[model samples]
Target chain A: MQRPLDVLGSSTDKRIIIKTKSGDSIFGILKAFDSHINIWLDEASIDGEKEVKLGKVLIRGDSIVYISPEK
Target chain B: MQRPLDVLGSSTDKRIIIKTKSGDSIFGILKAFDSHINIWLDEASIDGEKEVKLGKVLIRGDSIVYISPEK
Candidate 1:
């Protein structure tokens, strides 16, 4: 059976859109991740409202709703 | 590390709400699941609309946006 990691390739350069369990929508570039699904994103944004100046942040998998490749 | 199945527990009678990646919101009774996170739900509904007579269905994990205990 294919794993979630397999569903998503290991490239840290793909752009993705994420919706958090708390209902915050985000957009960013995938940076890194672990087995627990914890992820780091560069140039992230929330609800398309403002740019997250840090350009990098880690997201806990438990808070993840869905991750989609940016089209 | 806590797994998704562990996070949800083994109770099949609990009520749950799920938001799919396609954006349909469903309310139902959690029935069963596997490692892939495929889920069975009884009495499921879409967007809080009409009741689903089949009362049972499976949801693939990849399409899941979020799952929450009925609140």
Candidate 2:
């Protein structure tokens, strides 16, 4: 019974990666999502910053080139 | 003190709404966001479903037409 929201909600504590249309990749833990499709990504490199907000993004599931979850 | 991710994360418990590029609107509570920009929106009017997941969506901040939080 895996729901789509589950994917977004449970992504916390997991290493998630997102590839944008520009071919740039953003890697971080699942933070939060709102109606605006705004994303809160805690990037990997910044030390102890907790989370960095990526403002709003245009993410069509189709445009998502890649997604890798750390095991 | 308001970070972008904060917007996504705190949207929960609030009556949040999202406007899509197609000129359609989706209303719900903020659930989660991952690197892919995928959104977990708890749409309105779904009766006791708690939350529903909208697969990955293309949401450019600019494309987001409007957002109204319940007062």
Best by TM-score: 1
What TM-score, over all chains together, does every model reach?
A: 0.50, 0.36
Cα lDDT of model 2 by residue, A19-71, tens digit: 64444465666455444334444433211224333333223344345555666
Model 2: how far residue B63 lies from native, Å: 7.4
Candidate 1 residues B1-71, lDDT tens each? 77667745644679888888756686778766567675666666556244433344445576687788876
Off by over 4 Å in 1: A48-54, B1-71
**Per-model i-RMS:** 9.6, 8.6
Pairs that collide, model 1: none
Fill in the DockQ of model 2: 0.07
- Model 1 agreement with the true structure over A1-71: per-residue lDDT tens digits: 22335423533687766656665767789887765567789988777455455478898876764555554
Segments in model 2 whose C-alpha atoms lie over 4 Å from true places: A35-37, A45-66, B1-60, B63-71
Q: What is the C-alpha RMSD, rounded to one decimal, of candidate 1? A: 9.8
